[model samples]
Target chain A: MEQFIDVWIFGLGIATLTYAPPLIFAALGGLFSERSGIVNIALEGMMTAGAFFAIYVSVQTGSWVIGLVGAMLAGMALAALHAVATVTFQADQIVSGTAIILIAAGLVNFLNLTLFGAEGSPAELSTPPKPGGVSLLVPLALALVALTAFVVFKTPFGLRLRSVGEHPRAADTVGINVYRMRYIAVIISGALAGLGGAFISFNVSSYTENMVAGNGFIALAALIVGKWKPVPVLFACLLFGFSQGLASRLPFGSPELLNSIPYIITLVALAGFVGKSVAPAAVGKPYVKH
Target chain B: MTRRINAEAILVPFLAVIAAMAVGMVLTYLVTGWDPFAAYGSLIRGAVGSPSAIGATMLRSAPIILTGLSVMVAFRAGLFNIGGNGQAIMGLILAGVVGIKLGSLPGASHWIVALVGAAIAGGLWGALAGFLKVARGAHEVVVTIMLNYIAIRFGEYLLGLGGPLQEKGSSIPASKSFETSAQLPVFWRPDPFTEVHVGVLVALLAAGFAWFLIGRTALGYQIRAVGLQPDAAEYGGMSVTKITVIAMFIAGAFAGLGGAVATLGELERLQKSELAVIQIGFAGIAVSLLGRNTAFGCLFAGLLMGALDSGAVGIQNDNTLPSGVATKLIGVIQGVIVLFVGIDLVFRRLSNRIVGVFGERGGSGMVKS
Candidate 1:
């Protein structure tokens, strides 16, 4: 009994740590874009780009920090493309986001083929030294979550941002620069999401194709289940993480069944909790300055 | 007398494609230092230069057409069915299992049994999202995406060594080879060069059927009406709930058929682990977008994409550029084109102004549908 308890506790800890950074960063990122009236479903794609570019650059430069920086820039670049399509050009948010996701996947696979080849050659990178029992990025992610909560609930800028999302036309009447706010929000969101990607590459291990996996989408689900609030979002992320960890540590049954736990949890959450909630009035609609 | 050129619609998509291809060529050259002309030569030859290549392209296009229709069907009902991948995979697994079990039956009956199984599996999988959306008001986008992961994991589990579908006394992580009678028949010999089958014809026919349904039916009208304006549709006495459920079921069926074609017609076995993550479902979204959600448009888009995919191998073999580069190139092109299309209304407005200066002849540029 004691041994089982210990294993469970250990699994919980690891899962919490694993899910924290990416989930927190992605949720906060979603908050920024969605709060500013732009539905940023491209979070997954942006994170993937960040992960791939960070590792690619880090491998070449031998600096993890620089790799992190590269990831941010790459994410921002992709986000800017999305912004141009959805914000400036007034395209459909879902289509633009889908495009971004596909483009990111394509770019990563393309670069992988060019750099490593089809046989999945591992890219060599200088491992950034880290203290045992969880890396610095996890702490950074928690801090980010707290910071986001403060900004969205307590700050004037945050209020304006939320108003923009809730009613862009109303915000525009009140002299809020809807376009500018949304652009800034998306860019910031991209940067945070990119950081999440970098954490995976530098801290977890050398990057692999599809390394960000479906975490981006999972974070999006957390945002929805949490009702787009940072604090609640954190709890949602933790729950998902815990489930994932438990699934991974199970002693019996095939590991494949374990791999599906998070998805099943997400489905349940979506079905059970998310139905009663409502999204921002202007969530997916582009704010055209007519 | 003025001649209006729907030039922007034609030109924009055309230019976007050309631009993307040019960028792709440059990227390939930069990566591999291969001659651009030679690389393209190989691409063309691989896709259409020979009988086998043509067959291969057609085979690749089969699922894309169905998946594209799946997306189109959902979009027409104002839902984004990103779960096409999941639905298609479920269909494939169901077809595989049934195909194996019903091997004793006559070939025609066997095919019917497998196909029916696939349709049911895919339909139920899709209806899961629809049920959630209506019952809980959860966004289909998020739910569908989550379901995709579940489907993938489920597929992996079903194909595991200890799973029911696994071959007898075989250690591989895949199902047993399907009976010959269960396999989709080839239209012609693969010319000793490529693998293509009659599945391509099925895909083409499916596209036509989708077009006729969407453009010429009362059910399609309800879907379109709801898509255009849900509140107005409700005001007009249309049952939004029923439309949503039915539309999703139809969409799921199309995707399920796509998987059946690939499994029964192409692979002749259920290599779930290897075949599960092929991205045909997601790529179908690009096809739908490029085709502008029209049936004929999907056919052409699927063919173009299928050809490009088939050519990727040739590019790898013939050039120093990696095989995956073509795939990436297709992705970039797809994104750019969709982006352009997303802003198409604005572009149309601008072109209308330009044409006004020329004459009234250019005013008919807007697509009525």
Candidate 2:
């Protein structure tokens, strides 16, 4: 019984907590952009910018808090570009998103090489403190889930946002500013994704190239799996985190193959095992003001 | 009647390239403090200055052209295939298997068979995504992205320690070298350092094939019809499901051929590290978009991108900038180009005005739905 609690409950629980928050933050970010009638797959790009800026700021300012803010700003910058392209210019969201992804990657890696040189960020830097063997951001992430739920489902702004996403034409008739709401939602989405990226970097206490890997994509999967609801998205992220935790714990199996389990599960979720995921009616369509 | 040129089609892309290059110059100056002129001078010289540089550019262009065609085909069917990397991985693995295991085949048949096997492998991988989309309603973007990670992991396992494909009695995590007969025949040697193979010819053939398939064939018409309006196509007795799957297969096949050509053309064996860092798949996206999602357009765009890449190498060789800066700058330039191309409304108006000034009204470009 003790062994079972030690491994299955305690160990598994810690690992999940460590891994799931990033996905939660990013998935929630996806929720905002998507619910505001934009398909922002550039969540990955925004996260990349956040991840790089977090470490750089942490090193420079010697403050983890400032680092987190820097991360969000970086993400927001990228997201603003996405908004300009997709919302204002009425470009293909996917194409614009792809461009952002490439740009973020190149720009971040360029800055990393030029600033940090070959050795990378210093051996020591200010990272968030772990009060109970987990970072403070973990609880903050949980709080944001509740916060997001309240903001998205229980507010007038939430109603306006949903209206813009679902029926923008009608929403426009009702005096809701569709473009302003979308830009705000997408920018907020960037902030959240940036926080997610910061969490991943802070966990490691340093930055590495491609360190975020495909977690942004995984968070995207979580958004789909969670059906874009705040509570359900939290559960989906936890599920992915649990799988990652379990993969690390298994006594036997190729680590490479084991690492793929989360992705495969995401594929299965997207394949409709969790049920059909229907996007907002007006999502992915650019609204042209006549 | 005199044929009126569609000035927008030619002008917008040309202007976008100029805009992106300008952005690259500003970025280089702001970040590196390097003289943008000297950097660009070195870049151009590296791209087409010498026989060896041109050879290198051609070598790089071949795979990108094929992958570009891969993306182009899928775009015609109204599908976005972001899984070119995954498809290419599937192709390379099968190509590696055929190249390493099949030693008995005589002459060019061995390499030819390898390329065919690669196409089949890549096609099947792509078809899985299409099937999931049609049968299960899973978005291809998410599915294909997941597939890319899965393919990387799978390939890593195959080549990692104690795996089936790992070299026997060696510590290195890579497959055994291919037999001499399995390698592509090199037709040109610009210098002792550069051995140009027939992959360029293969890319050209594939581009021609794509042009014929999308422009001439009955299936091409169906693909275009479905892409334009799936509801109308379905009402007209076309199976959207079947077309999606077939188009994805063709897309995957071209990408797969790209992988095989790159591997057989360049490497002796498949290395484990290369699987994670393969940029050709994503590069295909830029190639397709910049090419305006056409076969010949892909050919020119791929060449341009390849030149930029080889030019980065030139920047490094000339010591014009710090190491690793040039490549990343080129990447930023490519991304900017894609952005400019995506938001081409600004360019369209400019092109129209220019055409008006010339007393020739510009025709509407192929506007993406």
Alpha-carbon local distance difference test for all models: 0.79, 0.89
Task: In model 1, state the lDDT of residue A279.
Answer: 69
TM-score of chain A of each: 0.91, 0.96
Per-candidate total of colliding backbone pairs: 0, 0
> Model 1 off-target regions past 4 Å?
A1-6, A118-124, A272-275, B1-12, B29-37, B320-323, B345-369
lDDT of 1 by residue, A116-186 (tens): 67665355675456566677777778888889988888998898889989988999998989888888888
Error of 1 at A201 (Å): 2.5
TM-score between model 1 and native: 0.92
Q: How many residue pairs in model 1 have overlapping backbones?
A: 0
DockQ (CA atoms), all models: 0.64, 0.71
Top lDDT model = 2
> Clashing residue pairs in candidate 1, if any?
none
Q: Candidate 1, residues B149-237: lDDT per residue as tens digits?
A: 88887887778878767787988888878877777767676687555666687788889889988889999999999888989998999
Q: How far does residue A28 in candidate 2 sit from its true spot (Å)?
A: 0.8
Give me the runs in candidate 2 sitting further than 4 Å from their true place.
Answer: A1-8, B1-4, B320-323, B362-369
